[model samples]
Target: MALRLKSLTLASFLIPSNRNDWDRHLSAKHNRILIVDDHQDICASMRDILDDVGYEVVVTGNANDALEQVDLTPFDVVLLDYQMPDMNGAALLRIIKQKQKAVTAFLITAYAGSTGAQDALNIGATAVLQKPINVVELLGYLADAERA
Candidate 1:
């Protein structure tokens, strides 16, 4: 059920607020990735692609479920949709960081311009990417953590 995406063409992965600060968040053991998105299709598609790449992927369709998972498991990276019915991604990201300050998180949104990428950066997110994401570019961006 993997959907091929071309949104990478938009080049919507905004640059990190600060390169050194972003690199400070990376670590060597970054195999586990948690994806929180209201859209089940997006969750399933990302899980499929990331799973195939040897990542241990866990995905949830809402904020509550994501929080439950966060409380129980330690994830290396978290990808959250900027908007969800239960809670916006920033609030969720803040809570997740409270529980595990070491997790590298990213905000995923279709409305990047309106989603407040700076707020996400201030809340400890590594980056913000628009929807229909380029999994290849995501992998490349995350590669630093893997190689650290």
Candidate 2:
């Protein structure tokens, strides 16, 4: 919850650099977003940034909380952390899909090309975003997801 992100850890994932991106961001108000990460700092940082740009963002530190959020409200997009104590990102995405079939989800992990990370793609992730998220790339995905 401390504002320690400093555009270093989260990087472009929290900053909107392009003008066109801002225009598209207006419509992001309609998009609901969920972030699942065990790291409280990252989750809070992402939530703050995305929420500022008009997204209805919800962040959780564990799978159970993430599941509870999914049950309470439908989200248009999800960012799932690949490594967690109870369950992996792929398994969680599978369960989330069962509840929210149309949600556009991304698997976020430090290991991008690992077998487990690749396995997530088959399960139904829109993309695999490497950790220490890039805000620009994330927004691009959101824009693309919106267009789709």
Which has the greatest TM-score?
Answer: 2
- Report the lDDT tens digits of candidate 1 across residue range 22-87: 455342234789999999899998999777656789999999999999989898889999889999
Name model 2 segments beyond 4 Å from true. 1-24
Model 1 scores what on Cα lDDT?
Answer: 0.75
Name the best candidate (by lDDT). 2
Badly placed stretches (over 4 Å) of model 1 are: 1-30
lDDT of 2 by residue, 86-137 (tens): 8889899999999988888888898887777777777778778787777767
Candidate 2 positional error at 116, Å: 1.5
**Candidate 2: minimum summed lDDT over ten consecutive residues — where?**
1-10
